[model samples]
Target: MVKDVFTNVVANLVTALIFGVSAYIILYIRMSGITQTIRRVIHPKQRVFALHDLKINGINRLEVSKFLSPLSEHERDILVKFHAARNGSNPHNGSSIRLDGISPVSNDKKEYTAHISKVGFFDFIATNLTAYPANAPIRSFRSQMATLMRSFRTFGLIQQVVNEVHKYGEPKKVEDVLENRSLANIISVSVLIVDATGRIGIVERTNKVAVSSGNFGATCAGTVGDVDFDADNPFESCGLREIKEELNLDLERLHFDGIVVPKQKMQPIFLYHASIDQTWEELFPIMEQARDISFETQAFYAVPVEDIIKFASHTRMTDTAAYQVWQYAVKNGQDNNWYKTLLLPFDVKRYLIPWNSQKDGTK
Candidate 1:
């Protein structure tokens, strides 16, 4: 009887050990998946496309419509709490544009019709707050809020919040919404200013800004607000407005370049290139007197076209700014030796889609 009891105890110990090991393995796998999902949402690869490759017709090119995507009760409460904690009152909730879909017009995949809808600024903030990881060092309000909400079990909570947002109104995955262009909560414009001397203008963002604070970004950028809808060229109008507001400089030649959709937030950035007759030295004084300089820009750097790649290597640039530089280099430096360096150290080719084979867009 003694021997039988001892054997039974040994068998129970072995069973418990096996069960514990199995449960640990299961939990680790689940946690690993959650981590990957969160990382993908936080740090997504960017896609860059040229203008001519896309067939954007006159007024019909971008069709805007009214869209009503209200936040859930939980999301509304979270927003309220965040505002109360951060600003002690609700901030300006202006109307912004949201990308609804991009319909492919042809089998060649070169042409697409872009569709957008109007969404409130609050909705934009709520949906896109999870784009940053909890530990992101950026001092922006959104990043801080994300950190506050997901400090505990960061990855799991991020995944849960993303899932909830995705399922709130539409049954879709966060990746699908961002990557597939199913729904982009916000659409903004970024402008690259090139001087007559072939120098690119770069700006350092101030902490007062809502996004990408303390980071280098495009010369000027702003959301495509509701006011742009009435303009003759809404996209260009938005770009020019940002230029006037941020740089206090006007250009007669503002060219629409293309669009870049970054995976991080899946925000569509309408890219513009403006040429100024003045050299960097001549333009500095005017920029200093910009109306919103104290609130928007910390400093401005005039980087030579040839050295942009090297500058990008050293500076912490916003994703849209990096792509804008890359696109500019590809457009002007293809035959130059500096273009080859873009392939070696940075390898931006991995991110930029191949230029349309028919450069002239001729069949």
Candidate 2:
């Protein structure tokens, strides 16, 4: 009888393993689209907090173009102001998150001045180390499982649930905050590359980007992340870091033509500017030198800004954030000069604009 019991146990173990493997195959085979599609589901855009909900971090030299360390005080604030949340992937939306939950907190990046919650971040700005292969998803199921080990052990979550989280490009440490969605804040950047000759730099993304495979977008745009910098400037860190990773340029070596601050009247709030030192003639060579291999870019074009406007209507070049930069640059002026528009009424206190400490101290 004992022998029969042991035999049954062994059989059950084998069956479970097989079932797990089969489920993994079905899920991963769909590739990165599944995760990005689900992200859209959770982070629907229209649900934006009212203008009052807008928390603006002031802009500084980092927004326009500076690569040196000891980034200006305003630049550091960009990355430092926002809280970091592990970008996890879970299908369920509208998860109930209470503000007055277990208030257990000490100090995290010093942004915990007001609201505090028991949960942590479940969203992420993927690091360059999480690079993809040319045009493939960042990783396959086996790889994500390896990283999820920490969470399984720490959070006491089972393989089935943790596996979903990892597969969705989220870190497992988020398991602690999985039940708390209110703490999540997603930060991303849209880079617009303009050369001296009035040509804008854009790329056709490969399947590696997950959601916008084959879409045309700003030169080397990406999102902000905790690893990008310990400093406070999110926009500067996000843009500069992405440039280093995707374009392979040494920030110290970059030549800045001038700062181009997008005016609120005509441009999206997210658009920030810094003209690269390289001229139009050298833009292609610079692009060819890109070091990040985890991505797949079909082509980099140095077409006239006007031509890009013509292509703007085409679905291929429709990354709104990036496109707005073109509108701001071309319409505001030709190129090669620092420009700033008077701060608009709506953007007075909520949006980050290049500010003068002595002049615009009203806020």
In terms of TM-score, the best-performing candidate is: 1
Query: Worst lDDT window (10 residues) for model 1?
Result: 348-357
Ten-residue stretch with the least lDDT total in model 2: 259-268
TM-score for each of the candidates: 0.66, 0.41
**Candidate 1 root-mean-square deviation in Å:** 11.4
Q: Which lDDT tens digits does candidate 2 get at residues 150-233?
A: 324433222222343334353222122222231232334566766676666666676445334566666666545445434455
TM-score of 2: 0.41
Mark the regions of model 2 whose C-alpha exceeds 4 Å error after superposition: 1-183, 251-269, 293-296, 333-363
Q: Listing every candidate in turn, what is its Cα RMSD in Å to the true structure after a full C-alpha superposition?
A: 11.4, 17.6
Give the lDDT of residue 60 in candidate 1.
Answer: 33
Per-candidate clashes, comma-separated: 0, 21
